[model samples]
Target: MAPRLLLVEDDLHSRTAITLFLGDAGYAVDPCPDFASALRHLQNAQNDVPDYAAVLTDYNLGHRDLTGLSVCQAMRRTSNRKAPIIASSSEMKYWEEVADVFKLNLVPKLRHQWDGPAILAKLEEIGIKP
Candidate 1:
């Protein structure tokens, strides 16, 4: 079976693009438009193992109170702790502050550019085969 991935992105365009890109690259992506949905999926895992092989989340979730950071933290607490959690955001400064502390790999989401290569590279660097 293709490796499963959890994609938490609030922007519809980005979500669709990423889901398609990863899907084409042989991953079964579970796309979530917001934190609530992502949380539900994470919490619904039937076993101690995570359903996803990796998680790619956007830092700015169109919400002031919560960001992808919240999702990453929540994932850490779940059985999915072993899975890689990747953070993507244009907000570099904000992520630089907490990424290392949270043990997350940040992939900069460039403006008007599809960062599929960078995302794929990070996934490989972390030992997650496509």
Candidate 2:
């Protein structure tokens, strides 16, 4: 079976694009549009463990209070804690915060660069083959 991935992106265009990209690259992506949905998926454990191989989230989740970093932190507390969490955002400011403090991987989302090469590379770097 293809590896499963959790994708949390608020922007519709980004979500669709990334989902399609990863799907084409042989991953089953569960795309979530907001923080709540992502958490719900993470908490919905199967056999007491979430089946996600990795998670990719945006920094700015369109919420004034919560960001993707919040999602990453939450994932660490879930049954899928060992799965890799990747923070993807055009907002360079929070990259260090996520990487340094939380030790999450980052894929810098450059505008008009939503193609999946960087993401795929990051996944490979972190030992996720897909």
Candidate 3:
């Protein structure tokens, strides 16, 4: 089966971009905008949706919205602790805040370029083999 991925990001452009590319990379991507809805999907996965192999979230979904740390917490509470969450942020300080808090692979977000390649590299590092 193809690897299932939960992609949580607030930006519409970023979400669409990643979803399009990762889908092209052979990953079945489920895109969510916030933590509550994302958790809802995780808690109640249907037969059509495959089990999530990993999670990709933005450090900040929006103003006072779904943060990566919150996503990590929900995943741990709902499922086992084996879920690997990868988050990225343009601000180093923001990414550093949640770096040691959970089992996350935090990637740096650059301003000029997109975060897709860094994400693909991390996915590869985790033996996703996609």
Cα-based TM-score, every candidate = 0.92, 0.91, 0.87
What value does the lDDT take at residue 98 in candidate 3?
Answer: 64
Sorted on lDDT, best first, the list reads 1, 2, 3
lDDT of 1 by residue, 1-130 (tens): 8888899999999999989998898888999989999888888763553478888998888898889888988888887777788888887777788977788888888893338989888888988876
Q: Evaluate residue 71 in candidate 3 and report its C-alpha lDDT on the 0 to 100 scale.
A: 81
Candidate 3 per-residue lDDT over residues 1-130, each given as its tens digit: 6788898888888888889989998888889988887888888663344558888878777757557778888888765246688877776577677678785787877772237878888999998845
Q: Write the per-residue lDDT of candidate 2 for residues 10-125, one digit (tens) a residue.
A: 99998999999999988889999999999989988544654799988888899988888888888888877878888777776786764877777877887834548999998888
Please give the TM-score that candidate 3 achieves against the real structure: 0.87
Better of 1 and 2 by TM-score: 1
Q: What is the lDDT of candidate 1?
A: 0.84
Q: Give, for candidate 1, the lowest lDDT window spanning 10 residues.
A: 43-52
| Pairs with steric clashes in candidate 2 | none
The collision pairs in model 3 are none
Query: Which stretches in model 3 have alpha-carbon errors above 4 Å?
Result: 46-50, 112-114
